[model samples]
Target: MNEIPLEHVHVAPDDGVEDDPAPAVFVLHGRGADEEDLLPVAAELPDDHHVISLRAPDRLQDGYTWYELDLSAGGLESSQPDADDFRRSLDLIVGSVEAAVDAHGLDADRIGLLGFSQGAITSLSLLLEDPDRYAWVVALHGYLAESHADLDPDGIGGKPVFVGAGAGDRVIPQSRTEAAIDHLEALDADVTSGSFPGGHGIGPQELDAVVEFVASRTA
Candidate 1:
């Protein structure tokens, strides 16, 4: 398959990169953020692992976005650009995974994903599209796509998912959060989630939780 031509930033450990296969995590930034924006958080992960931060396929102002949205419906709604962008985004992720596996011999069982906002939605959507491909997922301030329900649900059982939500988030509706949680649960994912004090942002507390979850999965 021809993978999407998306630019990305990668962080890898100094030692054993060529000699051993390590766990790999793909980090995704929110809308209006570049691949470099999420590098700090990716640094918090285990140093023995490979961290890949990807730039979105399309530019949105000075930064980039995986998808676009339309809030004209009084709430955020998926625009056609959003869905089309996702198809390309998912292809990028899959292609990256293939390259990682081939080049570094990274374990398929240890590959995971982490995303914030639009990135989060992209990560989750990719998992739903190919549930068996990713070992775990971390979604921050994201919602499920309407088409997610139409996908087959058999492959997601026992997959770990961590969702970090802002308790006071007015940017994303509570219903969307609830629906994502409920849908993941219905799909038999081992979902772990908590609400932080901020809105549409990640704090130290949420970061700690995310680290814990990633640790559990990576270890």
Candidate 2:
């Protein structure tokens, strides 16, 4: 299938090596946010790797969305993703990442993923769909997509993953994040997780941890 070209902002490495392909981190923003939303967070990451912040394909409210949510199950906490839309977004992301690698001379094997909310769900799904394709992942304020529960991908063992959630996150309850952690641990993934005291958003402490986690892995 052809890749739907995603709009993005590419930040070149501060100290990139001329001949060596630079490692990369792909940033995905939460629902209703744009590619520019996480540029500040990207700025805090290690300066030796390339950072690409992508815009979601579907426009939503004044921003964008990776996929629509099905809230009939209850509310945000119990909501599920529209399965077909989720799968389509996943494929598009895969294609976009591949294209980015080629277009920017990236080190594909050293790729990382950092996402928030709905974007976080997509990042985790991508990791599960093909573990070897990513070097590390940071998922914040999001739960695992139910559609990927049946997948049992190989090579996920020992992959680095960081899951963060808000203790008071009504949108995606703490239990959901814990479940994702448990699943990753069961698969032998190198998991590091934490919870902040706020609601459905990243706190200062959470941001610090995320920065540290990504730096350690990328460095």
Question: What tens digits encode model 1's per-residue C-alpha lDDT throughout 131-205?
Answer: 788889999988887656567566888899998788887777555777788888887889998888888888999
Candidate 1 local lDDT, residue 168: 80
Q: Evaluate residue 44 in candidate 1 and report its C-alpha lDDT on the 0 to 100 scale.
A: 89
TM-score, every prediction: 0.90, 0.95
List pairs with backbone clashes in candidate 2: none
In angstroms, give how far residue 41 of model 2 lies from its true place: 0.9
TM-score of model 2 (CA atoms):
0.95
Off-target runs (Cα >4 Å) in candidate 2 are 1-4, 15-19
lDDT tens digits, residue span 147-179, model 2? 887677999999999999999998889999899
**Alpha-carbon lDDT, every model:** 0.79, 0.90
**Relative to the unseen true structure, what is the C-alpha lDDT of residue 73 in candidate 1, on a scale of 0 to 100?**
48
On a 0 to 1 TM-score scale, where does candidate 1 land against the true structure?
0.90
Residue 88 lDDT (model 2) = 83
